[model samples]
Target: MDQQNGVQIEDLLKLKFVSDPQLSPDGKRLVYVVKEINEDKKYQSNLYMMDVATKKVARWTSGKSMDINPRWSPDGSELLFLSNRTEKMQVWTISASGGEPEIVTDMDHGVSNPSWHPEGHSILYQFTNKKDEENGPIIVDQLRYKADGKPSLTSQSYEQVAQITLDTKEIKVLLEGDADYVYSSYTNDGSGIVYVKFEEDEPESYIQSKVYVYEFDQKPKAISEIKGTLSHPVCSPDGRYIAYVGHDQKYSHATYNELFVYDRESDSTQCLTGKLDIQIGDVMISDLHSIDMSPSLTWSNNSEQLYFLASEFGNTELYAIDLFGNVDKMVEGDRHIYQYAMDDDAKDVYLAISTPAHPGDLVRHDINSLMEEPLTYHNEKLLCNITLSIPEPVQYPSQDGTVIHGWMLKPNDFKAGEKYPMILYIHGGPHMMYGNTFFHEFQCLTAKGYAVLYLNPRGSHGYGQTFVNGCRGDYGGGDYHDLMSGVDHAIESFNWIDSEELYVTGGSYGGFMTNWIVGNTNRFKAAVTQRSICNWQSFYGVSDIGYFFTKGEIGVHMEEDPEKLWYHSPIRFVKHIETPLLIIHGEKDYRCPIEQAEQLYIALKQQKKPTRLVRFPDADHNLSRNGDPAMRMARLEQISGWFDHYRLIPKTSRVANI
Candidate 1:
């Protein structure tokens, strides 16, 4: 077979991103979102349906805007989805057979997370209270007054749960207050609804939320009393139990969310996966999916077992846990199950799977036989002639002797005795794992004649809780050594790598590490940092979750221990940076905030260091993954060009080889 061309940045437009697979009540059909780039270079997600028996696929929506969060009606006669077809996101219902979608809600604020009433007469959705006037001076009195990619809060606007009747289209506020309410699910008996809300009107209150059951015509009752952030409440089929995913915040945000069940009769909660030592829920990262929906716990019809997705060893697999605390891995592999929807019978599952070879495709898995059948070929034609770099799993001992897991991709069109530049790629989240899933950026680097090295450092979640929390309060300490050692091991093990022509780059936490690496050493010829935090003091106030994130990750509050915060910040050591650096940030990135990038870029320029800053307008923290297609491509090209410009050349010899 002839070697085809490698993947280019422009090819992103041709690839189809799939997500949010939901099964019909009868389990005969599957509804999912197929996100593709439009002529305007913006993403447009439309609803697609698949026949479970015949494997036939068809588009259910033809909207020019995003049509997502598709939920099946109780009778499976209509599909309720959130669409912005009218220029504002709202609940829209379409016949299951495919027809014109009817706008159900006309609320001023956009709606999300739509759930149909078991009776199929009304819909429960979430939307923030919009101010009466549109144009006015902004005034913020709360600590968390602004969120990334959202309008600045001039007045307090809390996310409230509401219901809209299909017949009259009359909207009624089911729950309202200063606190934000997120709709989870209705009780099995349909007597009340379950949701997660934070009622304390304080800055610190944003870090904690409680699961509540709001009974009709009654006050809400708290089900779980464990002191930690809780979410994804799911009532059992018999209404005797409630299952949710949460942690005790023992390690703060570094703590893995464990699956827990609340016994309504006993009035107690138990951690079902206490011995699993894995993070529950979807932790897989992919650029193919515009929105990675949270994992929903599915209950067996008998109500004896619960099924959910968990991250272990860099892979997200489906697992089942019984009421007796016995856990079983239903699906385990090197691939990533980004999102899955279980049938009502709980015997089959529909998954959005991504492997090292392909971006993503829909598939059906049998719970008993574990057999998988592919359902969609959205990216088949595009990938037919495109060569992808397959990653080889590599493991090495860190500086502290702890084993670290990683993957390395060799440059495309490799030849014997040929040397190529190497790039070390670090993942963000610090808690997120760099796993077996396909990474377009890493492949792009290899396509440009550069070997790529990516790994799950100490703070990554695939390992146990201890390993995931090992980097806390020790940023740039053990974790830094782990990354550096991985690079050293890669160069020593790969004889074709040009050790002298090394480059480093990462985003978010990885961006912070990139800054720290360049500031601490000059070994790499070039470095690129994206949406990185440079100062903890400012980050604590400006970032959406910084107040708690900094305290939890750094193990100290800014006011309590300013010295420690500054000690770990990379900006303090900027005077020592010697590598040619490029900074990339999204203008609307409130998680790390664009100021984080601006501060670093300005400081480096003041010292006359080789640096450039590229900002993407109308983009948030997820620019590289879910931002505008044009901006994402520009980001890839910028990073590639910056490294190429500063790449070192191998020494030449006059003698010719025979």
Candidate 2:
């Protein structure tokens, strides 16, 4: 808790990210991945284990490699994980007791989702059946041709599922063909494997995806009765029920995912968390963690109570749901538990948690007694000398009189006599929550003497379904006013804040709003839009998620309502913008393609508006979060530098300028 120096962009490389806490079967050992940016400006993670009894810690995998996705054998005798110690990421195995590791798979495209079989003899994993692009033209007829971070070419590959035996090293392809198998797991007896298959032959592949339970020598049968997208399907230990996280296509991608259990005995799928009104996953937006929208579901050993993580009003906590439609909040706190794993009987659980003041660390919690204990201090030393800002939870009435929840952070060196400049940060998801998590960007801004404000607007998760769907067809309507109200409330309530020195910035959905705000009003001094969209008409074809996302958000397809799309587009209002705007985007961002930035930049220049576009080469939509270390820091520098260039503070005592 050092207040001498605030958190700077250089600290981004020094922070350690704790994730995917996996408990050993015997409940005596803990294994998880600790990722950090090295001096080389690249991410490196390795598996680390800790003894639950003595609280002792040791490295399971070492060296400069991205070793992750660790899973213990059924008996806890051996462990398998994916590692890039070699050229391409492949499966590697090591004994849980500790020993030298050995490679298992050598696929060209690499393998992922490594899990042990029921008998603990083999491993099941996923790989792409990629066709050689050099051999011929990469022709494709699928609508889902390109994706963010993927090669910019028509996909000539299909997903395949396979298993490898440890003793014989024999590999068998269990599932393959035209469809993309996204997620997979083995049943209790290892008799069948439940996997989510996205059939790419149709136009509505994202919606028509079904969860199938494929048994060896038997055809894969659709177990999910609902016609919606699902992932991370886990079969019960008794093989009686299968639990997964997803939602029907009622709201498409914007739908709040609910936990559903498919009963094999009755052949019926029941929604377990329908009455809870919470998204069944960690939907909080954090730059410190990976981009994992897909939530995980873990069933109890008895198969009666299923444990999962959910977001409610900006707090992601652990909950347990039983068969009788009863849900109990097991671990409630104002913190984000992004990843957790339970012991054999689902009693002793380990959680990776974070808050505003702390980066993140692992904690062990007992399910029955609700007792908790800290297990790791991975970021303690790195953060010991860094002064971090603690967010004050705030709420205000929106334009519709509905209450909007958010957090406000004062500058690191705040004074009562001074007028502090403020910046409003809008989260991208329009559906993701700016929750009680450690955001490196916000802290960095505070370090440079700027108050930070971020709110989970209408389309954000953690709120109820209605609020999340509030912005679906009404983009820039209620969502826009909600943010403006928050800003107005902050300025009026706080006497220390200077309303004239205000600034705004956001990414993706927030980016679009930044564009919208500058176009609509001249209140803010400047604005920064990252990985944003300006024209919906063009975004529909270029963005990877454009087709369905546009239809889902705007409630119309490209041809269905061109005028309506233009009406919601920010580029259409470029002529009204007066604020100096900085457009930051990734060149390889398929989520919000570079063309989106291109259109807005050209339009602003044509109007002779003050604007500049900064594009990071080879970076994707996650440039601000999980991009290369140096690039991430540079992006932060650009954002802070832009705001400081228009510094309304009168060139006072500066903290550290870039």
Candidate 3:
């Protein structure tokens, strides 16, 4: 038998990530976004079309910038998308048969969430108003003034909903205020637009958004009366109901978004999946591509049923709910359905799916037959040459007897009786699940002769709401124990694991956990924390959503509970750290803010605790996943080399070296 080499960091650049599959009005053709790393070391996403029956694919757009948000016009004669071909991102239109795209909207700020009217003569887009620069000094009067990867509030603008007539190119602002509006879709009669609006005047507006119907030349009316955060407002084709994804703030930021339907005729709202317990909407975490916001709720043509993707037990599957509140699983498997598009008939579904074996591909799913047929193989050739590791699912009880779900990826070229160093990889969204999905980082580690262990702790989604919210008020307390216990379980279950050669790494929330683990224990020999939050006190002011996020996640206000914030912060316990640490941060990371990493690095350096800080230029919090290709590979190389340097070599290998 011949040995296949493991996947290398360079191989990651070659993998193609497909997303935003949109079935045409005729339901025979599909257009989607294929993102790949270009020669320039940056990601370039272009539109691609696929024939449903022939399984043939062709490139539809070519350019230096991204051509995404491919939404087909109602007549299917043209495709509407958001692109940055000009100086700024704007809405553009290209023929359905593939031609040069024409700029449609010339708004000062970039446009997003483009939707076409049912008549196909006009388009609705969302954009923020340009900031008033005439008034020299910028004012910071709002609690939620900044966002990660966006301009600060003082220089920022309010998101407004606008419509443009196709023939005349006349534009009209339908909704404008000190609020951010996300365009969903036009009403059945095309008399109004259904959107989620976040008004700055509301208390805790950052966490609260209402679904509203904005009529032309008329005031907007709220459709969602629930006291919770709401988004993804989708209208049924018949105009009888509005489907949305949200949950009451019973558990604050820990609440899962459940599917709900608003009866337009009855003027009442009903929770369809309140008892389902699973988190509704896409929860798949990937390092291969960036997923933009799209409509998650799709209604059947008859308006009798609604279909949505639900994150359950670690994988995303398609689920359907009827108007009567009967829930049925439409598609269930170990693969992640990141995005999907329903045909005009609503009988077939085109899905962008990723599994442990492949990065992503397009598939045609028959709702009635409950079968899926492969539609495109974008990475078939690249994957054939790569040796990928399959993860083995494991469940173990934490220190507090809470069951933790995790997976262990053995080295690609596993040898019996041979010990392999293990790496514990934590996910960013502490609320996100590490499920049965393709994780390039874990695969790369295994390819490099390292076992990778990842788990969904109490704070992670996929479990019931209670389990997901368990870690809200206790960031590093129970969640920390769950991770450590998972590591212990992995070591005990895998006899070939070299327990002493264990390493740890994570980003965002995971990064915070990595910092917390090092401060509380010295089990990990080396650690790499990326875009981590070290000081909650400073994070509340510096981060884009820090003010509200801190209160929701840590369950404390910076003004009222300064001591608690300091106590839960990893920097407070920095003196106890002994692991050789590597801090990786993005210069433009407004989420955690680069200062988070700086504070930890300086503290570790002051104590001479063997630390190094690597700051990526022009990169944000998503640097690991969607940053420059060169930087992504560089990060992986650094992480692998750091682990290799600190890993304990076996006696026989040590003797051979000597």
Which segments of candidate 3 are over 4 A away from where they belong?
1-4, 132-136, 152-155, 291-295, 648-658
| RMSD to true structure for each model, in Å | 3.4, 3.2, 3.1
Candidate 1, TM-score vs. the true structure? Answer: 0.96
lDDT of 3: 0.84
Assess each prediction's global lDDT (C-alpha) against the native. 0.85, 0.86, 0.84
Clashing pairs for predicted structure model 3, backbone only: none
Best first by lDDT, ranked:
2, 1, 3
How well is each residue in 479-588 modelled by candidate 1, as lDDT tens digits? 99999999999988999988778899999999999999988887787899999988888888889888878999998998899999999999998888878789999998
Compose the digit string of candidate 3's lDDT tens values, residues 250-314: 88878878777888789898888767888887776778755432337888889999888888888
Worst 10 residues of 1 by lDDT: 649-658
Tens digit of per-residue lDDT, candidate 2, span 1-658 = 4345688888887899888888877788889999988778789999999988899999888888999999888888888999998878899999887889999999998888878899998899999898776765667677888888777453677778999998999999998887688788888899879999886656867456789898787887898877777778999888999888888879866788878889988989888777888888888889898757656677787889888888889888988889988988888899988888887767777889999888899998887898999889999887777777899888999989978989999999998889989999999988888899899899999989999999988888888888888899888989999999999999987889998788999999999999998888877888999999899999999888889899999999999999999999998888788788999999899999999998899888888877899999999998888888889988999999999998844422321221
Give me the candidate number with maximum lDDT: 2
Task: Provide the lDDT at 488 for model 3.
Answer: 85
Give the least accurate 10-residue stretch of model 2, judged by summed lDDT.
649-658
Which ranges of candidate 2 are over 4 A from the true structure? Answer: 1-3, 135-137, 152-154, 648-658
Better of 1 and 3 by TM-score: 1
**How many clashing pairs does model 3 include?**
0
Better of 2 and 3 by TM-score: 2
